[model samples]
Target: MQIDFTPDPRLYPFQSRWFDGSRGRLHYLDEGDGPPILLCHGNPTWSFLYRDIIVALRDRFRCIAPDYLGFGLSERPAGFGYKIDEHAQVVGEFVDHLGLDGYLTMGQDWGGPISMAVAVERAERVRGVVLGNTWFWPADTFSTKAFSRVMSSPPMQYAVLHRNFFVERLIPAGTRDRPSAAVMEHYRAVQPSAEARKGVAEMPKQILAAHPLLARLAREVPAKLGAKPALFVWGMKDFAFRPGPTLPRMRTAFPDHVVVELPDAKHFIQEDAPDRISAAIIERFG
Candidate 1:
């Protein structure tokens, strides 16, 4: 059942639309006109993450950003098994149900892998990819493992389960520009309680646990990733996936693709450099 989405018009102004998805009623923003542009967000975030981008590009493109099964305004049923593969499957179901073939895709954070997974299944359907601060490699690097351990610690779990720190602090911290008070409020308000934040606990842990899945995706996704137009708009200031690891691996993955790094931005480039991102999308895949 849809719950607690008192939309702050200044924040997420778009109308909420739903799809009778494989995982119940999936909520999305279907706006504007022309070729479809699919924006996939990551953990602890929803379609709302792409609100700015949607508003920026909706004039020329049909922007469809969906909240995953247990995210945003979507139904987060108990014991939903929020796995990587399952998330990828629903994306496929979402596009298929809408009969969208030959469209654009943009992914950030966990949205990166999810879009790649969807591309594996629906390559022919995808026109190109807007690769933001995200990667597709297995979580085996020293940097990745270290991030996983820190995130899985007792303090972290307490923050996620009780304090709603992931939504409150981390998302804002990821942005170099620092989102406004209203923006941050809407971010936290979407998942107002502990129960609403269940997916938060499971989502990041997958980065640690999905090595096998990532390995398989590593082997399979590369063959198809470069088949379409790919533009890598990276946030160079990202602490998690900076010069240490994520960016390099992604660089190797899409060697031929265009990469525009934003030194001013952090992990959440969407918040920091939405106009630049939107411009890149228009130039490369518009």
Candidate 2:
């Protein structure tokens, strides 16, 4: 698939990097030169999601944000499944290829599972973790299941494929503050065609189809990386991944974790509270 989108330099003024992993070529941002912080993104978003955090923290931390294959400026290779497990696999290869001896992991949305999967494998090298509105267990809640089913249904899938529903509708609804027209267009331009939106469309289905992987992470993450310091920057008002249940479940895995509650922010905490989130990261993992 050909993506004709170039990031606005004023908004995303960083050098772009690429990694040719086992899966495909991935576009990433590697800025600053201190302790590395790997930023993993979620559905319908890309490295672009972390632009603010990277700008704020890059002065003191080596901020690395990668666009997973089939998203952002990454290549959408033919025949790729675009499954959660596949994303984890590709990210794992990216980590190994980078030879990162020690780094911090930060993830939100699907990023939580995918980044943690990498951390679990490289537990010795992972010094800490930062998580936001996301999950790594079998998503069996009524709301989760209902959302997955409805979004994966034919009509919703069609809307996502043709109309860019996630970027147009969910991205706005997920954040307390609406994104600017430029920000929305940056997202829309990347996945302008049905072929480019394949990864975005596959994720809703993966919520159910990837349960076994989630189940594995539920066990393995706590067992292996529970000792690592954890920070939960939660968006309390998030429609999905509500703090009431989700935060406690995460605490069960990281009993010694620190929590930074964002009462007004929603699912896309990166968008709504990047400055606060950056401050918390510097305090906890600086």
Candidate 3:
């Protein structure tokens, strides 16, 4: 019920900006000046999810991480559509507004689709991609327990956003290493208000709908991306997108891509193993 607007010290000294005035204010941290790197976070997390990577990569590459509408410090409009296509459009507009060209992209969870959409739609700007614990394929069968709940019972929405139980319980459980009290509190601080929760609450339905856009993206992204230097950093221990299930699909899509499996990591690979993940990105892209 309480929201902490305090900015993280680690995220300080970076310029913040907003775009797509009518849609919602997107709070983004932009730093350094070089080939750009856009970092996108998944559900229940925000730009803070990419904090360590931003710090590690900013010195050599221009790093930009935006809190999606209805998450983090971003404004949550009462009736905004949080569907995949809309999120992808916002990403496209944001990149166009910033005039970013020939940059690398890193994505996780929902970010996986959004970033791929951007690359498929705005190919000229994206040079490479770094994927972590996510999927871009269409699936009729739900994969994870959390996803199965969402698909089976509509009431699960209340448990996730309204009650905050899902965020409180699932996030920490999915991590290989329990996050520090401070980090856990930081994650909770951005909890959406009842009205603002609509965006997140609607995610399950949207995902279930398997909007044609996602299917289109799934088919087109691999072809568009080709062998453009991709890095697949996966968490073998992730309960949601288990590597056994998704890795082969990803490998098929990106045959020439480099793959690294972090056996000790979980869904939040960046949080669970920041140093190793950062080192891998720098080694590949720096």
TM-score of each: 0.95, 0.99, 0.92
lDDT of 3 by residue, 196-235 (tens): 5555665556665545876887788778886678899999
Q: Give the TM-score of candidate 1.
A: 0.95
**Per-residue C-alpha lDDT of model 2 across residues 47-161, encoded as one tens digit per residue:** 9999999999998999999999899999999889999989999999998888887799999999999998888989999989899999999987999999899999999999999
lDDT of 1 at 149: 81
Report the Cα lDDT for candidate 3. 0.78
lDDT of each: 0.82, 0.92, 0.78
Model 2 lDDT-worst window of ten: 1-10
What clash pairs does model 2 have?
A: none
Which of the two candidates, 1 or 2, achieves a greater TM-score against the reference? Answer: 2
- In model 1, which runs have C-alpha deviations exceeding 4 angstroms? none
Off by over 4 Å in 2: none
Model 3 worst lDDT window (10 residues): 143-152
